[model samples]
Target: MDTLTLKIIFMIGLISSSAIRLPHQQQNKQNTVTDDRKTPLETGLLLLVFFGMLALPLLYVFSPWLNFANYKLPLWANGLGVVSFAIALWLFWRSHQDLGENWSPTLQVRDGHTLITNGIYQSIRHPMYTSIFLWCIAQALLLPNWIAGFAGIIAFSIMYVIRIGNEEQMMMDQFGEEYQTYMQQTKRLIPYIF
Candidate 1:
């Protein structure tokens, strides 16, 4: 098929994979703690970033107003986008699987939460963040519009820079020295290369 068609297909698959995980994540939210560091500002920024990165791009994909299809990169870029998306999905799923009930959509210590250090968590303190970074890269590659293509990376970087310290502080508070030790062993987003 055409390049746009292939790009659309990859985007749809990425969205579908993300959508499928939502219900499962909601079910697990029952284990989350009432007290959380998910401040209103943080939540607002997250929503803004989500809209900019995902929603706006999806809209741009189907609409003419923001269409920059004429600026599309070589077909290999789209292929790379698909590969990045596949890796993101795998990392997202694996991180959730490894975290189990301890996983929270925000910064919170779950009831009976244990510091997870095995599986994908063994090397990356935030595999979910890594997965998201992958998504940003894929989005940049797949979307032709300048705003839609790069918004994810910009927004995600803002959120990550602002939130990671707080997240680690919360973990350290909850797990004490254990979390500190885990932090020493793991990088934030990359394995052996952060």
Candidate 2:
């Protein structure tokens, strides 16, 4: 199919991912935070990710400002995007479902936050990041534009790189031996690999 068709599909997937997370985001709002690690860096990185993954892609889809970055992918690449997006949406939903009220957008431990080490978390420490990475990969494949397509990965990689150590430290501080043991038992983003 054409790139516009693929772009529309990508937008639909984006919207669907948002819809799936909306209720969970709202649920987290009511949660009481016992520990908050949110900082200026966190807020800034969030904005960067917002610009990269959401704003830029939407701009590309709805406006002409980004057409200069437009490019083409093979039909097989588009097909692969469909698959990657499917997996991303699934993992995104499942991560939320598994985390439930424990989910927080920023670095904060809820009043009753427990170490999640079952289901998807059983294998990987951050399925949400994995899902986001997959979405970025799919975005690169589906959007057919350099800026919009690859921005998610670039932004998220920065966040992941800067935040992961602190995240593990936070978890280490919170759960101590349990979180440490969990870390030993699982990988960060991938399963049985780096």
Candidate 3:
């Protein structure tokens, strides 16, 4: 792989790892506690979303039409998507770094997990998800394949819908008045415009 690719991966790994420093602490209810683990059905839905994202690129490669041979993406679209993806990755890294040990994929809180209101959090309540959502849509736009494009949109939509509910509930419980005030100031997905 190229150096740029390696650097991106390293950045992503470092951020993700740092954000998830204390998974066990997050699950300990004595913290900002909640029992919001997904139901079996929700878990299945989440798995479908995860696998769909993973499979779409592979399917595109082997697709008989070679991702719609006639529907090549414009060079500008490809360039924009690549750049958007890179930006989304950077945003994810920033959000993750800001989150630090407070991050948890599930609806659990860590000890001393103060509400973060600076950096990306100052604008949107969920910058990491925002970036991922943008990246997913950009992938579809850039790929110019009906299957890949729609799959990414649908898959991410499904994941976000489920994720936001659980996340908000937990945050509301943990941060209480503080989170409520933050929510009033910031949009869920978009910044000031939304």
Candidate 4:
């Protein structure tokens, strides 16, 4: 297939995978508390990353002027992107399923949140972050434009660096020794090797 066709397919898969989480998110929102630990800076960073990764890519795909469409990689990279996207979507779906109503978009704990340690969470403390990292890698591989391709990674990295410590702290506070044991047993974003 042509590069453009592959790019389109990857974008569709990425968007569809993200879209599927909306209902689950909304369902869990009702249980979220007002005590969000995500600071304004973190929220701003997240919004910036979201805009760069999602909106900018779509804009570049449609207009092609917002981003410099240079640095085309090998066709095999696109194939790798497809596989990465598939894994990302699957992991994302499973993570959400495992979290169930315990999931929240931000740093707020749900009313009846329980520590989930099964499915994708069995080995990774942050499988959703892993899935997002996969998305970033896939985005970088699939899109030819420099800004559109690499923005996801740059943005996600910033968000991860800023939020991960706080997230773990919150989990540790809530789950106490149970979370400590889980942390000792699992990696943050990757399994077994991270």
Candidate 5:
């Protein structure tokens, strides 16, 4: 198949996969209780990050009719994209496994939960966010076309910057000394090497 055809097929697969909600860490606990403090502005911006970062690139791919004159990438660029995406997917799966029932779109403490210290959580306090960052980076590397990659990176970065502080403060308040200890032990997005 030609390049455009491959892009179209990839776009369809990407959108289909992302449409469904996936599971997270801590299988035995209930993870759905939500705090009610998110403002409409926060929710709206987050939705943009989630969907726009994910969907827009596929839209550009499948519907070249809507393409905004993207830069052409060399074959090597596509290879870089694949590798980045592979690493990102690995991190995401690890994060989900670590989170189990503790995972939710919005921040909420799970019922009868302990601070997770195993797996990816051992290296970074927020593997989920790290996954997100790497995912965006992968998109940027893969697309190399600038618009899709940069869009995903900037959108996700903004969302995390806005969301993380609030979430961290809330966790600290809830877990107190335990959370502080964890904070001291783990970096936010990178491992001890960082």
Candidate 6:
């Protein structure tokens, strides 16, 4: 209904997204990486993603520094954003739950990594990434400010454009034909659609 309400909704979404990932991030530190595929480009882009997704948004949400760029959205759009955020949070949690020990923050494969083709992974090759994309969409819809609202999509788009192919290649290298078959069967971001 109001600007503050939308910002609060965005904050809730941000916190929810973080809460979904927190446990997995913690667990990942204890796991050894058997295969490290991180490139300098990826490492660097990830930092950009960090700032774009988290830092910039946090600054806008907490401080009035970026308020000049604020815009307005229709009530329907704001509702859609809330729904989008809800779905994004669910997918985020489910992706992590399905991946379990296979999850890693970087491009490295964990020591006991296993190809996940069940649960959320059954219909999507990269549900976690899909969740992030959806979350970005929610960010765009929820946050009225230009920089904080849109940075997630822009930075994540760059990361996804550069990283998805490599990530798929890594999967193919590890699982070979099995991953190939899985790829053919499932869409990258959507189910029954691409």
Candidate lDDT (C-alpha), each:
0.81, 0.93, 0.65, 0.84, 0.67, 0.91
lDDT (10s digit) by residue, model 5, range 1-194:
24564365335435433532243323433444544446686787788886657677766665564455566667776666666666666777777767666666665665655678888898799887876777676666555445665788889888888888888887887789999998999999889854
Pairs of residues clashing in candidate 6:
none
CA RMSD (A), model 4:
1.5
Which lDDT tens digits does candidate 3 get at residues 1-194?
23233224433433443454344344443455334465686677667766555466445544555435325556666566666666777787777778876766555566677799998999989987887776676556455666655576688788778778777877888889999999999998789876
In terms of lDDT, which candidate is stronger, 2 or 4?
2
lDDT of 2 by residue, 1-194 (tens): 69779988998999999899999988998999999999999999999999999999999989889999898778999999999999999999999999998999899999989999999999999999999999999999999899999999999999989999988899999999999889999998899996
The local distance difference test score of model 5 is 0.67
C-alpha RMSD for every candidate: 1.9, 0.7, 5.5, 1.5, 3.4, 0.9
Quote the RMSD, in angstroms, for model 3. 5.5
Q: Flag regions of model 1 displaced more than 4 Å.
A: 1-3, 32-34, 68-70
Predicted structure with the largest TM-score when compared to the true one: 2
TM-score of each model, paired residue for residue: 0.91, 0.98, 0.74, 0.94, 0.82, 0.97
* Candidate 5 residue-wise lDDT at 162: 85
lDDT of 1 at 31: 78
Candidate 3 wrongly placed segments (more than 4 Å): 1-36, 62-70
What's model 1's lDDT at 108? Answer: 76
Of candidate 1, the 10-residue stretch with the lowest lDDT total is: 1-10
Where model 2 places Cα greater than 4 Å from the true spot, the runs are none
All candidates in order of lDDT, best leading: 2, 6, 4, 1, 5, 3
The candidate scoring highest on lDDT is 2
Candidate 3 similarity to native, TM-score: 0.74
- Give the total clashing residue pairs for model 4: 0
Q: Which ten residues in a row have the lowest lDDT in candidate 3?
A: 1-10
Over 1-194, each residue of candidate 4 has an lDDT whose tens digit, in order, gives 46578668767976787686998877975774745776798789879788867887787677758544667678788889888988998999888889998888788887777899988898999999999899889888887778888888999898889888898999998999999999999999888888
